[model samples]
Target: MNNNCTEVEDPYIRYVMSQRPFGWNFTDPPVFKPYEFEKVDPFYWVSLMEDNWKVAFYAAAIYIVAIFGLQKFMENRAPFELKKPLFVWNLSLGIFSVIGFVRYVPGFMLVLSQPNGFYRSICIKDGMDLPTGYWTLLFAFSKFWELGDTFYIVLRKRRLVFIQYYHHVVTMIVVWIVGPLVEPISRWYTVLNYGVHSLMYPYFALRAIGIRVPVFIANLITFLQLSQMIIGFTVNMTSLYHQQIGNDCIRYPVSIKAFSLVYGSFILLFGKLFYDSVIKSGRRQKEKKLL
Candidate 1:
């Protein structure tokens, strides 16, 4: 991490620094001449996200009803073989996630690369008024589309676990809540999610296309999910510690608790998932072999 990052004056960093919405007067002076503020990154993203976070809650409700309704509808019917559609769906999500990861990870990296980067990255409100913000917006909206994943599960007569739906519903709402603010911790959350989906979705695409993905590879995906949950939990606790000690960087104690609870639940859910799929399944396989 460069203590004098402002001194380096990299053009890319300059551009990103110039693009923050809530005014970062980082010496270079965010000029309105050649690089007009609107041209660099639109301001409407923050407004739209902050304004419409409630939409996520409504969407989640609709998603819950639709999934259960679909499940009941499909209970008496033969499962449709929508292999190609599923393949396309997973592949599209994979590509979308990869693009988001590519575009947004660097913003957080840049945050950490700056002086006091780690703390500032955790505390500051680097609003979404940059190129990275666009992808971040898409990442949140993508949750709405992700509800379709459950539809696929229900229609296919696959078991739709509580963790799966619960995670989606809560995530959709929370991402919307924290997205516009782009809280330092939430920034990390978005990056981790993009990274995980980047790997997980492509693997799903391969399976969707009838390719024989290895069991170990599937286990690895679950492992990554568990890792994400643990990391999220740890970060929330760290943020809480900062709050307790009178850190003026952010004032989100209740939000932090909510985030912690969500991540903690995930830790339990994904841990059980890993145990059932990996550890217990491995034991069963060993027992069968011995038999």
Candidate 2:
């Protein structure tokens, strides 16, 4: 790995040095112009390696404790009460999720319209003047709000599976961190995700609102989640290749690779669980009926 970084000989760097002399000032003179921040090259990224190392440690600590600790405690505890407002809150989010889904379709088409075509999946869209910073900020903030899913699950005394809760919290943090940290090649993942959530949340919302959906529809949603993971993996792989080959596509950096690996693995694991719980169980039930 090249540890060498381009020394900031740009006028901006000199001005920055004049102010702080240490090259790490976060105040006035640096003027927070949108997109004015220096392009984060991979080599310079390691400079943050030490400072941000705590994020991983904290993530791991939370995952271990939550999986082994709070989950076990909750499992053995007395059954908790289910109330009305929580349902109402979930319904509201369901509404927002649907709205988010509508936005995703157009956003995705915008991505597809690029000269590289949809399959190529470039992060920085060409010929598309779509909202960049604000959209990213919204997506990041939405992940935080998604923490409500877990809160509701706990409050209603649902069995919080390790797969479910861990994925939610960790993903919430990951999405938040990655959105601004690395300008990924395919923003379509965000849009596709919103689309899935749109359908998924409404299903939850319907359940909360006391509307029974066919079991098949729920299964279908799970299938979509798996499909989303496949698409994401494909896109990330394309981005990785294009980056390495110097195809002018945006590079996803090391952190993105780590994030995608974890995310994709979890999705695959969850898909297996869903298959076991749904299809395998159904087959077993049919066998019992025949007997």
In model 2, the worst 10-residue window by lDDT is 21-30
In angstroms, how far off is 173's CA in candidate 2? 2.4
- Lowest lDDT block of 10, candidate 1: 25-34
Q: Model 1, range 115-178, lDDT digits (tens) per residue? A: 8787767777553335455566677788888888888888889988998899999888877765
| Model 2 TM-score on a 0 to 1 scale | 0.70
Overall local distance difference test of candidate 2 = 0.57
Per-model TM-score, in order, reads 0.82, 0.70
Segments in model 2 whose C-alpha atoms lie over 4 Å from true places: 1-78, 127-133, 182-186
Cα lDDT of model 2 by residue, 1-291, tens digit: 222224544442333223321211222121123233332242233234322434544654665565456546677676555546666766677676665555435545654666766543454534222233224345655765665566556645677777776676666656644543334443666777777877887787678767899988888888888787777777777777776776765544654575577558867776797788778978998999999
Native RMSD of candidate 1 (Å): 9.4
Per-candidate Cα RMSD to the true structure, in Å, reads 9.4, 8.7
